[model samples]
Target: MNYFGLNHKRNNISRDSLLLEIYTMNLPLYDLTLIVPTFNRQSFALRNMRYWSGRDIVMHVMDGTKLGLTPLQLAQLDDNIHYHHMPELSIGERLNEAIDLIETPYVTFLSDDEFFIPSALSSCISQLKADDELVSCMGLSIQFEYKNGNVIGRRFYQSLENYSLLQTDALERMLAHMDPYVMSSMNSVVRSVVWKRSMRLLCIGDLSTFNIGELLFELAVCFQGKTKVISEIMWLRSYENKIIIDHAKTKSFFIWWRSDDKSEDRSKLLSCISSILTKTSNEREMVKSFMLLALNRYVNTYDKIIIGKDFFNDIIVKIWLLIPNNIKNILRLVLKPFIKFNTTNLILLVAKEWSHEGVKTNFIELCEIEKVIQYFYKVEK
Candidate 1:
């Protein structure tokens, strides 16, 4: 058994007591609900959920796939696991549905291909229960590339490595710093009340606008209360070729902005910003900072191809007009290397390397890929 110890100062319960509770299964140590939303990935979901089936936590599986697990199969897992089949609903709707059934005070979302470290979840629960002011908490996720049921490479996702609090002015500073990977459902745990309120504020839109909705909810949580960022890498994310290919193709600025469907999504994001800004003076400034960060994210998606082209007719250009010259200069300086050189093509090269499975790989190559992943979040910090 791999037992991990928590910092004694963070929790009132002793390590021996917690371990005894976990081993004896006679008492519940925390109030946490782990939600796994699965769609057409039964094998992946089942493989990952099996690890948690014997645990004391409440694990809810919202299955929306064409061929999901049967009740018999679910029963085989454990009594602690709850299975809900809602095949007609989308991922976002399934998540909302699962949220409605949560009886725990703290809730966390897990994807079919993500796994949590046992000690990390317990540590986060301890921290959240220790601090009533904290609305959410998360740790870094380590991403692994897999092919033919074999792990090819591993790297940490864009994540921080130090314990930090995002409250008061720190919230604005973190949002302004704008780490796009910082706010993912797979890597976060939030208070149920905060999650409920934030979800209610999300705009009803097409599934393509799901990311926008999630971002708004995360921001609302951060704005409403403090957020604890744990530096430990406590989650494992499985990366497949289809995801990389789709991301490479869809993340292009021209492709994302030129789509007719995205126009409505953009408008909805702006509307969300408007609604959030109406709350308080500090929140208004924070929302404005988030808007600038969002713009920078969109601009950063522009690779070498679109960076040189004139986007005079683009709606995003109007947004660029709203940013102050100082920030605009900073963005330009940040993106200049990619725009002027062939550095942006490194993504394609990495993708190509992954295409050749089981090829001889080195630590340096993996580190290069890690750098590319971190580039999205690197700012003048």
Candidate 2:
């Protein structure tokens, strides 16, 4: 392992000893504890578990529900997978619990609605073993949309796959401003020991936090360490109509109205960034500079205006007057019919509209789009 500079502490784990540990536990062991935390979405989780079973992957499915499984699904679960129920935990808490039961050296949290490709785990393991310094590794995640039991999708959701594998130091600098890689507990695999170190940082003063949970864990693991990113798609994430999404999109300014305070969330995020900034002089500037750029994009991409007495309606009305009157009227007319259609139909219509602007090139570009279709077709690993 490349234990340079700050990672010198890991030098105690010599190559021979580490190799012994690996060999004793079956060197380069493919064993992985797939920790999945699920709520009422038992059906989706079950299907996802079944998909992973083809790879002979060990699973630790944690049910964050009080009622346990709906009898039928419980009876249907494969014996190879272990299922446990714990309703008194948040997603992050459940993840911590699941990781505790993992006997393998590596673990990857897989969300119930998300799916993994066949070779995703194998690829991730190879990258990690090849680069002994990598604290963790992640691969590309192409987005897909499903409708009416039929799947349809689009690729390069935000062009994240455009970038290549990043060094831990470089990624930390970037994350100081805005996270380049999306923050999700389920997207990547990490060394069990690294995760255990992170769990300590995640829980502060015996009071566990939730919203910034995964972000904190990622920051801790990547702190002055190495990380790898496989360009190949590994995870398939689905964000249909989740409650977390609803919470994040809140526009209400009533500070007391929220169940959880966001002040902590903002503080934890800033702290993580500030820690990274202190690492290097050049990195400090890069992090702050990129953060500003991301903030601007965030404002532009997600704009909502609220007017008095319109608590329930969309805030898009406020921007309508800014456009030329003729174009505004034209949009209103065109959008009315589109709004009447179902979300899937509307997405297809919009996708067709944007298809002309797509930058189609060679196999790589085609591969990108095909990957999206693969996710929809359950081909993603």
Q: Which structure among the candidates has the greatest lDDT?
A: 1
Q: Tens digits of per-residue lDDT for model 2 on 1-381? A: 121212212323233432232211112335566777799877667666655443456788888877787667666656657888888876657766765687887778777776655355666777777777775776655445665533444443344443333544544433532333445332567777766656544544222323334544555565535555555555655645353633332333223223276656544544455444355767655544444344333333334322322544445566755689999768768988666322333222233333333421122222232334335346532
Once superposed on the true structure, which residue ranges of model 2 sit more than 4 Å away at CA?
A: 1-29, 70-72, 156-159, 162-186, 199-210, 241-243, 246-381
For all candidates in order, the CA lDDT equals 0.57, 0.52
lDDT for model 2 comes to 0.52
Q: Could you tell me the TM-score of candidate 1?
A: 0.60
Q: Which pairs in model 1 have colliding backbones?
A: none
Clashing pairs in 2: 116-381, 117-380, 117-381
User: The CA-based lDDT of model 1 is what?
Assistant: 0.57
Error of 2 at 180 (Å): 5.1
- By summed lDDT, which 10 consecutive residues of candidate 2 come out lowest? 1-10
